[model samples]
Target: MDKMDKDEPRWLNEAELNAWKAFNTLIIKLPAALDSQLRNNSGLSHFEYLVLAALSDAPQRALQMSTLAVLANGSLSRLSHVVKRLVKHGYVYRETAPGDGRCTLAVLTDQGYRKLAGSAPGHVEQVRSLVVDALEPEQIEQLRHISQQILHAMDPDLPCPDRR
Candidate 1:
């Protein structure tokens, strides 16, 4: 006999369930660990590091705040708050975009560039510690393919972040 719950879909198969549980657990745990590392060492959160890194990588070391919000997977309000903090910390400066006075650009300061450059190697090592070192090469490939397939179904128009 099959039991149905109003809010739940079909039961996940064993393999699917295992994968989902693994991903979910990793998602919750990895961020906390990374956030702790960043805060203790750099006086920044993981998301802040991400924002600075993304801007540092941009051509002019500047990006539209809306675009940055998408790249950071943060809401506009949330991004504004973080950007405010970054500006206060002397890491980022904001200015109105040339063509659109309404749109704001976050420009990474030289200090911010130095901060990202300093933090990145440690961050990469942390990522590797949690993920790459734990996975076999074949499993890594499987993860990449599975993630892309899920993302494609969810967002056909927007390419994956890694691709962008």
Candidate 2:
């Protein structure tokens, strides 16, 4: 009800300011670091790796192309481009879904599975170095909670599946 408060800009307090800065830094830096490691060690970009990993976890190592785009947090166009590259590399194959003529499915081939198996160790190590090992166990739990909270705020309808 105070006119003075309404006219003044709402600014972050010290703790909020610090937290925002740290979060901003992570959003900027973490992807680049992961991308660098994947590119150097496996000749895969982080997005490609994410796409492959999502497929790897799917039942029968296959998923509808649209489902995959959602799982990989990519647009349909981006997924199409990535899938094309993967197909060229013999890592994946695409075909129409058996029961659904309109839906396309992306399947991981043996070669793709083997490639992923080979590259996984290095990628896991990089993840550990960059994230897991950087936090205490409790902090890791906090991070998971915080991340889920943010995701919920961003899109309440989005599913956040727990990895086994």
Candidate 3:
């Protein structure tokens, strides 16, 4: 709280630096690994898979575009582009929300559902292989706690799809 303390750069300590480096590496590598598995197995990017999965989890397999964006952790514009691609592939379609002309709803088509169903097993297996299987039960719980804490720190209002 002193002036000198405030002026000094608060750099990471040795332990903090090591933890950060390891976490940074995981951050860089995990997505690439997941994306590779998804692309190779299902011909979908990780973001695309997230979009489809979010829609598939929704009531009537449809959600408002804004809600979908939040659930997918993507920007509205990015969701729009991906939805357009899905539409072109006969996987999704957009329509004005019933009784709400201003809101656009993105609905997953039957084809999209089928694609997601087909993709889920492989994705789950890859996730298990890479993360779940690597951790003990206690560590899994710890990891969940740590992740939630970090996510809460990043965005206190972040909505969890499962909780919703």
For all the candidates, what are their Cα RMSDs to the real structure? 3.2, 2.4, 2.2
Off by over 4 Å in 1: 1-8, 161-164
Measured against the true structure, the TM-scores of the candidates, in listed sequence, are 0.87, 0.92, 0.94
Report the number of the highest-TM-score candidate: 3
User: In model 2, what is the error at residue 25, expressed in angstroms?
Assistant: 0.8
lDDT of 3 by residue, 41-98 (tens): 9999899999999998999999999999998989999999999999999999999999
The lowest-lDDT stretch of 10 consecutive residues in candidate 3 is 155-164
User: What C-alpha lDDT do the candidate models reach, one value each?
Assistant: 0.89, 0.92, 0.93
Stretches off by above 4 angstroms in model 3 are 160-164
Q: Please give the ranking of all candidate structures by lDDT, highest first, separated by commas.
A: 3, 2, 1
Candidate 3 scores a C-alpha RMSD against the true structure in Å of 2.2
Give the distance in Å from residue 9's predicted Cα in candidate 1 to where it truly belongs.
3.8
